[model samples]
Target: MSHKKALEAFYHKLRNLRGNTRFVGGSLILFSGDFRQTLLVIPRSTPTDELNPYLNSSVLWRHLHKLTLKTNMRVQQQRDASAGNFAKQLMDIGNEWIQIDESSNVSPCHQTSVRSLKA
Candidate 1:
């Protein structure tokens, strides 16, 4: 099916489901790859300004913003977990290096040379 027809069918299905559920508080998450680029081709008969759904005032964008607000909480949680994991990895690697450094039997002269080379 054509892009336009597909979008229409999707919205129709969404509307039907929403109507059946009587769920007014939910958000719809739709993904189109680089929507700005795809929009140009998807709504072939419409003008660019009207077809571009990402604009802040557009109906689709408003729904997306609501959905994004809900997802932002989860995103923050994931980000925090990822940052903690990264910090733990760094600390573990640093401790390994410290152990290696302490066990190595390098003379003061060798240490100075290594430091100088690093600099």
Candidate 2:
């Protein structure tokens, strides 16, 4: 199946089984593996750029109160790449938040935190 179709089907099934009482809460953590290296039960090859944001903004992310981990279960090479990309993406998002806050005249505590981040 094409990546888009597979994702659609996955979401459909998730929606169907969402309130089946087997699962605990509204959170659904979907982990996609490297196309070159299979990690989880789901298909091994999907475009990360296309799905990363969807995963981040999905019900799981929105509902979950905390994010304990975001680690790749693949081997060293894929793990390193995923980790680096994840870290950079997080930092960029944080910086964007700081920029937005600065434009709005952030509170003193937030300003201090931003300065510490810059350092």
Candidate 3:
């Protein structure tokens, strides 16, 4: 994730280079990456401190609109329903949209995949 200052710097540079008064010289900036994902990993820093450099901390963040992607293109290309389910599960965990309780019993998947993963 880019720091807000870095984004602002590029924004101003782009605006100046294009010779337009509009933001980013009215050029559509397609900012990728999921903002909903994990916060910036900081060693020996508090959560508040970590957020200080995040893109959303900038004043420009309010003006930008967010668009969500509805489909997993990789899963679609692979033509695998199981892959879709796996991707959904991973995304759910990453987004904190679902919770799975840790149990003592090991799943058959874990038992089977461990060997394959080691190989």
Write down the lDDT of every candidate, Cα atoms only. 0.48, 0.49, 0.85
Global fold similarity of model 1 (TM-score):
0.26
Candidate 1 vs candidate 3: the TM-score winner is 3
Query: Candidates sorted by lDDT, descending order?
Result: 3, 2, 1
Question: What TM-score, computed on C-alpha atoms, does each candidate reach?
Answer: 0.26, 0.23, 0.69
Which has the greatest TM-score? 3
Model 2, residue 89: what's the lDDT? 71
Off by over 4 Å in 3: 99-119
Model 1 clashing residue pairs (backbone) = none
Root-mean-square deviation of each candidate, in angstroms?
17.1, 16.1, 8.2
Worst 10-residue lDDT window for candidate 3 reads 110-119
Clashes of each: 0, 0, 0
Pairs of colliding residues, candidate 2 = none
Tens digits of per-residue lDDT, candidate 1, 1-119, equal 12444544565577687765322225345554423244444443567555544444344434443322213354456678777666566556645643455566766654433345664
Q: How many backbone overlaps does candidate 3 show?
A: 0
The full ranking of all candidates by TM-score, starting with the best, is 3, 1, 2
Better of 1 and 2 by TM-score: 1
Off by over 4 Å in 2: 20-25, 35-119
